[model samples]
Target: MKSVLITGASSGIGLQLASDYLENGYRVLACGLDVVKLKAVLSHPNVTHYAFDTTSVEQIDQALGQLSAPDLIILNAGNCEYVNDAQQLDAALFERVMSTNVMGTVNCLSVLLPRMQAGSHVAIVSSSVTWLPLTRAEAYGASKAALDYLARTLAIDLQDASIDVSLIRPGFVDTPLTRLNDFPMPAKISVTDASSRIRRGLERRQRVIDFPFLFILVLRIFSWLPVSWWQSIAASMRRHSL
Candidate 1:
């Protein structure tokens, strides 16, 4: 049976994916910060649980040292915090988001990459927020944007090693994370739907897998608009929010 390792397996999309993969007969290495939560979801015989904070490099290294090389590694652990008042500029909030989303992924990569072989694949969970500037997403969007670039660059660099990289950009999946959002989320999908789409995309080995067709289409269109136009729109939105 093929093996896969998923970070953030305690809840949301990660939990769903871990369950689905177990059902499909793959051995799963489930990593999450919450030991209780991680154990609750990973009850299957094929699933092994590792409790480690993604923000801690030492923790990631120790956890990874105990596992064998996985055929697929999903670096999906991340947190999102908005800049509610950009004028105030919450540097702490920005640091927290970047530490978890960007540095967290890097920490996992440092430990996981060396163990992966030529046929192994790495999937980075970015967000569709990177497609356009959105209100209150200053920190969250910037982090995912960095991840998008990192995944693309890894794709190019890992080509010679035959290690495929897949970038997953989901449009608001209805997970615990999004449950905290105060704004309306268009085309919000269930965790099951998100996991299904992501697995299918991985099977096809697509470079980019963006979900909810219409949502992605809209974002892509907006991304094509002139920079000044989007800037004006963003500024107007910021003012309205104030």
Candidate 2:
């Protein structure tokens, strides 16, 4: 049986992916920071849980040391915090977001990459917010933008090694994470639909898995607009939110 390891399995997308993989008869190595939550999700016979903070390299190394190499590894553990007041820059908030979303993925790669061989795949969960600047997404958008670059670069670098890298950009998935959002989310999908789409995308070894087709198309189109136009739109969004 092929095995897959997923980080942030405690809740949200990670949790949904873990359950989906397990149901599909794959051996799942579920990693999460919450021990209680991790245990709850590992109720399946084919699933095993590992608790570790993704931001801590030492913790990742120690926890991952016990496991064998997996056929697939999804670095989906991330945190999102908006910059409520861009005029008053929050360096600490920016750092915290980058530390978890960017650095945490790097920490996981350091330990997991060596264990992976040819045919193994790595998936990084980014956000569609990177497509165009959104209100209050300064910290979150920046982190995901960095992840987009990282994943694209890794795709080229890992080609000869036979390890494929997939960049996943989901638009408004209904999860615990999105529940905190105060704004309206258009074309929002349930976690089950998100998981199904992700699994299917991975099975096909897609380089980029961007979801809610219409939403992504809109963003792609908007991203191609003139810089000034986009800037005006963003400014308007901020004003309305205020």
Candidate 3:
């Protein structure tokens, strides 16, 4: 049986993906910081739980060292917090968001890269925010943009190793995370749909898995607008949103 490891399996997209993969008969190593939550979300014989703080390289290395490398590894553990006041510039907030979304993924990659065998697949969960500059996405957008670049760079570097990387840029997945958003989310999809798209894309060995056709299409269209025009549009959005 093929084995897979998914971080953030305690909740949201990660949790849903864990259940789906397990139900489909894959040996799943559900990695999350909360053991109780992981168990509660995924309580199956085929699932094993590994708890670790993704931001800590020590924790990731020590935790991952205990097990054999899986055929697939999904680095989905991340956090999002918008910049409430852009003028104030919250350094701590940016650090917290970057430490988790960027460094956390790096921590896992550092350890897992050595463990990966030929034909292994690794996926990094980025956000479609990289397509267009949205209001108050300072910390969140920057981190995901870093992830997008990192994933693409790795795709080129890891080609000779026969390990594939899939960059997942999902737009507004309906989860506890998105539920906290004060603004409207267009074409937001359920966790089930997100998980299904990710699974199918990975199965097909697609390099990038961007979600919810209409949403991504709109973002792509907006991406073509000149930067000056987008700035004006974003300013209007921020005014109405606030």
Per-residue lDDT of candidate 1, residues 157-230 (tens digit): 99998999999999999999999877668899999999999999999999999998999998888789999998
* Candidate 2 lDDT tens digits, 11-66: 99999999889889999999999888899756888988898999999999999976
Model 1, position 205, has a per-residue lDDT of 95
The Cα local distance difference test for each model comes to 0.92, 0.93, 0.94
lDDT score, candidate 3: 0.94
Q: Write candidate 3's Cα lDDT for 18-89 as tens digits.
A: 999998999999999988888887899999888899999998888887577899999999999999898899
lDDT for 238 in candidate 1 is: 68
lDDT leaderboard ranking: 3, 2, 1
Query: In terms of TM-score, how similar is model 3 to the real structure?
Result: 0.98
Instruction: State the lDDT at 211 in candidate 2.
Output: 97
Candidate 1 runs further than 4 Å off: 235-242
Each model's TM-score?
Answer: 0.96, 0.98, 0.98
Q: What is the lDDT of candidate 2?
A: 0.93
User: Candidate 1: TM-score?
Assistant: 0.96
lDDT of 3 at 24: 95
